[model samples]
Target: MSDEERFVYDGAHVVDPLGDLEEEGEKSAKHNRAKVGSARPSSLLYTYGPGAIMDLPQFTIMPTGLDEWDRIWRRRGPTPPRIHAPRLRDVVRMTLRSPDVQLCPYPWQPKKHSRSPEGNDLGVPSRVFPQWLRCTGCDMLGLLSQFDYRNTHPYRTDLAVFEHAKCTGRAGSGTRKATRRTAIPARYLLACPDGHLDEFPYDLWVHRGQPCAKAELPALKMADRLAGKGASAVIQCASCDMRRPMNEAQGEAGKAKLPQCRGRHPHLDAFEPKGCPNATRLMLVGASNLWFPATYSIIVMPDSPEEKASDLADRVRTALGDKLAKYRDNLDLVRDLLGMGHVDVTELPDHDLELLLQAASVSPDTPAEQEQKLRDWDPVDLLVPEWQHLVRPIVGNRAEEPKSGLTLATRELGPGLRPEITRVLAVERLRKVNALVGFTRIDDMDRVGDLPRRLAPLTRTSRPAWTVATEDRGEGIFLQLDENAVAAWEKRVLDTDVWHSHEEAHRRNFERRFSETAEQVNHKTRLKPPRYWLVHTFAHILIREFALTCGYSAASLSERLYAWPAEGREPSAGLLICTTASDSDGTLGGLVQLSEPSRLQPVVTNALRKAARCSSDPICAMRTPQDPEDFLHGAACHCCVMASETSCERANRFLDRRFLIDLPGSGLGFFRPHG
Candidate 1:
């Protein structure tokens, strides 16, 4: 039916937009279930995850919490099919404290006409939001139950909508003059920081704090003048003219006017028994802050030795074919057979022997297939694992070896490169996986480090054992700064007044944010080494410069900073600049071409030269943290070091172009400009 765009690929991988076209007049469409509409499965992870509001073509919806998911007829929630990304899963399990947690791609039904359960079930379930709606024809307003819903969507899905079918236009003080008109949702809603959402009280607003003086079941009407902003819109009671402007329901004015939250969760279709303690802020359906997803993202590591052994075991099984089936129950027999060199099997590692034993136990795949899933997870430190991959020698072309999703190769590092940049690598291919842990309202929760209450839940029931995820594929250029040069630079510049100011600002920002929540602050909350800022700022500058050379926009590209320096690992000061599914892509031709020796030399030089003086400079370069309340960035604005929030991991904080170039009195340029 629809070509749904799934996840927003952050260049860690290729974005998988799910679905095949539903052929017109297809026989199975006749067997279609009670489907209200469809959405891109990717949206479920990024844009429309559980508890987030969305405007479908016909009506508005808030997808139910994960507790209600199903494929059609099952009474219990669905155990969505698994998708492997073990490092990410372990991190989530450790964070949520559910040791056996799993990761899965968002569920879907590829076939529409099949009479089977999957085809019969709706992909994700949702409930109509803002229960109150305004009839577009007469401005008549009421709850969804009060309006008449019409569905011709089974045959004509787009036309499914609520209509004021009996509207004789403002069923008058004396007359009627209106035809049927489609109804639209009331744009306003109320939410608290605790993530409770509810319908705006139109009656309460129109009538002040009193009961409707005219009638008990008074009909309400909304009128938009279309001349100005929220102030121009008006609400009134049909029984009596108790009118109020829409602006009264916004900001502090609305916060003062509205009642305390009942702790209503529209997605769960229930209100908390004790009610919410925090005040509810008014939100429009389209507002950006209404829903924020807290997700864990990881670049898939190169296959581990154990995983490689699993692959070899499978190949041996295939070579042995039916002959291996008879020897399945005896582990010694299988090991000896592999030892006999019928399939070129090498000395099996303990990992391979374990897999072989499992294969021997269950005759290939029995119902107990999960017995084979026991493998050690990759390290929970995301960047360290990826850093290892980035630092390794890139694989040259090999026709005989099976193709991998990730193929990286080093470009010739000639004399052209700056001495500080150790090497240039062309990541011919890469994969990134993003998993939705939960969401929040009013605040953008931090996804890094150990912090409490960083996210709200996706389900109201038990802590979920599994969550939805999506993958993206892309290629990029990796630049590793000289480690000794960076370490020396940090020791020299870290104690300056300018650097101390940044450290103070970072401390204050962290305290002001987490203190109010009353959660314990980790002692590790101190500011990190200055090279992180250098590497992070460098990544942003290159993203902007590469847009001009690589034919991708500044927004399409993203940066993954490897700068988390705590006590044990090799000090990380590298970054990956990647993009997936861009208009300018010629596969490997775009990003990889820029990493070549001839092009890379000038590219890095020009990018640094450009950062030496921002267009907004003097003012931008001279900028610093002025007030305690505002301590996010320094010497970085839209004109220079600041990057698209989607690209930069830290929401554009801890950036200072001054660290990359001399800013008058501040002589902290890590890459001092050559005369």
Candidate 2:
């Protein structure tokens, strides 16, 4: 016996811990009102009789915080009862309001190795737990803590022994005494709503050998006739003589090792039973508050293309029953459709109209679409202003920029020409000015022009009768001598200090002097020896210096030059020819023969026959007036500068000759030429 039970004295009835317990029992049937001082609402206050005076306070509407009593009442309404809140661990819940987060069906995995001798498909398929049944994170331990199970008990029953049993009721009269007892005095068993066998304890009377039926079973038992026949038999239990079904008797027997009922009273925690797949043995166990409904849905408004979308929506809703039709008058879906150009909103449909109305009653997507449709209604008059600003410049188009009174060509001819110039500039920046300079070299290798021609080389026979040679700083300079040169003239470099830096300034001075000299000589020579020879000579100097510095033999340099280009034209010049010459082995630097091979003759005779169109000035000659040459010579191309500086075969010699690696002031510095 428990310590609490031992406290009961032999003569005393049940003790009353609550002082009003007797009063409560006496007043249980009365619904009478309490005195006016009572805190609870009373029956008197709710009575509708004419003479029943309501002494309660008058109802008054007041601003929320403006009234002190209203504020206090509002604050008190949300406070929980004095009891503490339930903990997540201690909660034994049967129904959940929110949808449970789904976990991946296959969580744990097994390794791919053999374990048993009979290694035949020893792999186990993944076990899937019912979505509503199991706890997510932990192994089942966490789920057990949520329930309060203090009121449940277990019982022992012999199923085979009760297969053939019977019970007979016994009654007693005080004046008359029975000679023999029909059965033991019937004792009542406390019943559990959840079908648990262990909640109540009683005794049974047995006749033949068969299970007996209960005299006072609950409504479900009487109405449903539950319990299948001839499966497992339910006999009146000797301890708790309640008539249980065969399955119930067997389940109790299986758990017979649990604590047995010993005159202790137990109340079930709840009445509902759980049906979880994870449970090992199926038995009746009660769950608290376990009713739930099954399915749900949602609806949204369709997008609108025309203006009367709201009216149309209202009409549709009115035609259908308000409870059955969802009126989607909000504008959010329509706005989204407008932005996307078109949309099909019929794809998502909802059977429940009320749910659809709740979802899209105030949509933001449709309102914006309606606003835009109104704003862009007219499309014909959009571009009138732009055309007005552009008419004047189109009529006076010219080739070059004008200056001073000549109108200075407004920087660029017009807007249309600027784009082409920009495109050309962009190409130059990407490929470098060497793009123009390397034209002849590429042409020679790829056969770029219509006619193929060759230039004469200056051999022993081609040497003039009289040649003037001047030695300056270990470098030999050669010039053709003629009688017209009467003035003792000297070429001098001026403006040596006008550069960004001292070295750059000096380098510029050197190039300027060389280029100026070459230009002057070009003007003097002109058509006499041919323009091809001028380019060839300049190209030869660059190639020579480049090859010599890079450690190439003179013969190899000559061969490379000869293969590159023989004759080509540039934008400013015509049918240019070139030939190459070099000493065998490494003894002498290579040279390109620029003139025809003919025996030396008188200076005057040589000058006349080779006489280009010369003027009064001996330094001046008839330069081939411009030609419509579609291609450019390699020597004059700025692209060649970038190519030679970067990947040209003659880069070293060209750099040695002090040639600029890139075009200067050409606005194409970003480009690097590729070979």
Candidate 3:
């Protein structure tokens, strides 16, 4: 029996590190397949990811000059192959904007596919003001939300050269100076069932150099002189079934020109380019961005912090400059309230209210007392749910609702107009939340008050006292939350409102007793926010949930044990195989290492070997597919059990084989305790 069989027979609860534990096991919430890894399914989008959708708009432009062509052909060869650059504007206008590509947002019904009416499509949603932008500098095409897609494509040398030129910011010269000269042309004939142009357009170009064929010539044979001399060798066009005559084939230079048709026909000559050195073709996966009708530049929007603040100030000043002088006239009343003890608005003199109203109107353009006006202003002019709620109960209908649906509180106000009231409330709320959750009471259910400050004297700060919200049920946990601090939580996911509540909970837990000193608080928090960011970026958005769920267990995820050692010092090469007694059985048959080992191996090998057998398939399988021709396939093979224990020396030493033993000292111990 395999080690995996042993683990199961011994009652080990095996975990698949890469498996969707939340979906496959236990009572968890159901998730949409599309939103498994992204914030699209979450309510709090702001905290979901860093590239939050802020209001400010930004743009980027792709490369558009022809000079990029010459350099590309120099390295990759002149062939009618696929090019993976940004889609041109004309392409986007003709392809993506077509009605055939669009599907209306409706339920249960199959999406209607129709061609786009020329120049008649509605533009992007007006409400969206994107602050993030990605540009394809090579094709002079700017990637837009409505346009670009991702897919693997064959590699082409010439196109690669052009793309490199744009990346390096090197513009080419001549008639080809600013135009796209690098993209060679090739025709792809369709094997149509009804010969209908309306149903299908010709396949778009993919720049990979290799052509579609039943069998490719050996790489070594292609470079050898004797191989070329073989008269029986032939080159056939995939689209038209044209075979090149031996005399016409000449050499690599002759093969470079994409064959139009087989025979020496006038139509074939017109389609084929004579002496064209860059016309090789291939079939592969590809996608296009929004191709515009005409060339356009995407200008970078002003998002600098200073500039944004300045703009807001300028607008405010422009709006309220004329009223500044009247507000400052009652400076004495303002100063009295500022210094007075816990002075509520009702306690202030009538003159103070007048001054406060005037201050609210102060504009950013005011040259003199503008600063003073802002300082004396109350932030309540901005929306404050707490103050509004409080004022309703305190004032008891002193102010009447207006017929125009406008009031002191409900009136439209810009960000600059409501500093005092909004700022104070937000800051205080942030402080409250932070202090409430901070190191006050570890188990606040029964015990309450200054969370028995357990920090050593050197690390101690001012410890605040706490009270219980519920003592009888063991439910209350005191944690202060203020506007400024709480804003961080909202800001984290404000862009999309697709926030991760679990991460928010973790953040609150960490904030209770976090410090800047790495050594002091590093190990305490395992929020993995940065890791969340990376997973979404490199892989699909759904990878985040996978990582999060797996991370719950130190054994399965093993963030600590999964070490990415420095270059040239990677782990030893040990083949891990997963086998079974028969196709029907998922149980392990046997295990072995491909080679012998030294003493300095990892202690987790035995555990890994045992765990490997516990599942029908290994947990460490790569999510991506490998090249079928590459020799490294074995390195990532899904099958390949260890040969035998004698040859598996390295694996035995690296992995603690004791984990293979049938002992009862498990995490959930089965051994009896001493009496």
For lDDT, the strongest prediction is 1
Model 3, span 1-675: residue lDDT tens = 222321111113221111322353344522211101111211111111111111211221111111122222223333212211111111221211211111111011111343333211111111111211212332221112322222122221111211212232123522334322221111111111110001001111111244434334211100112332433223233343434333333345544443422211110011111322222321111111111011111111112355333333332222334533543465455444333422234554667455454544543233234334433332222112222232233233222322211111122122322121121100101000000011111122111211212110100111111100100000000111123422332244333211233334334434443433223444223332322221111111111122222222111110101111112332110111111111111221111111112210121233223322322233322111232221111111113222222122111111211111122222211111211
lDDT score at residue 286, model 1, on the 0-100 scale: 77
Q: Which candidate is the best by TM-score?
A: 1
Q: Distance (Å) between predicted and true CA of 280, model 2?
A: 11
TM-scores of the candidates are 0.79, 0.13, 0.16
lDDT of 1 by residue, 1-675 (tens): 111211111222211111111332244443323456667654677678888888878678787766556332142243456666766776776555443467766556566453445554336766678789988778888998877776634546677688887777654535575467888888888888777788888888888877798899888998885843654679899898878988876667667778888877666665565667878788888778888888888877766876555545544654455666687666566667776645443466656566664653344322233222222222326778789877876547311112336667777776857788886778777777788878777877752222343356665543455677777778889899888888888888877887777866766666676665325554235465688888888999998888899977888788888875545666678899988641222254587788888988888888888887878878888777755645667889888778886678777887998888787878898886664
Candidate order, lDDT descending = 1, 3, 2
Tell me how candidate 2 scores on lDDT: 0.20
Runs off by more than 4 Å, candidate 3: 1-675
lDDT of 1: 0.69
lDDT of each: 0.69, 0.20, 0.21
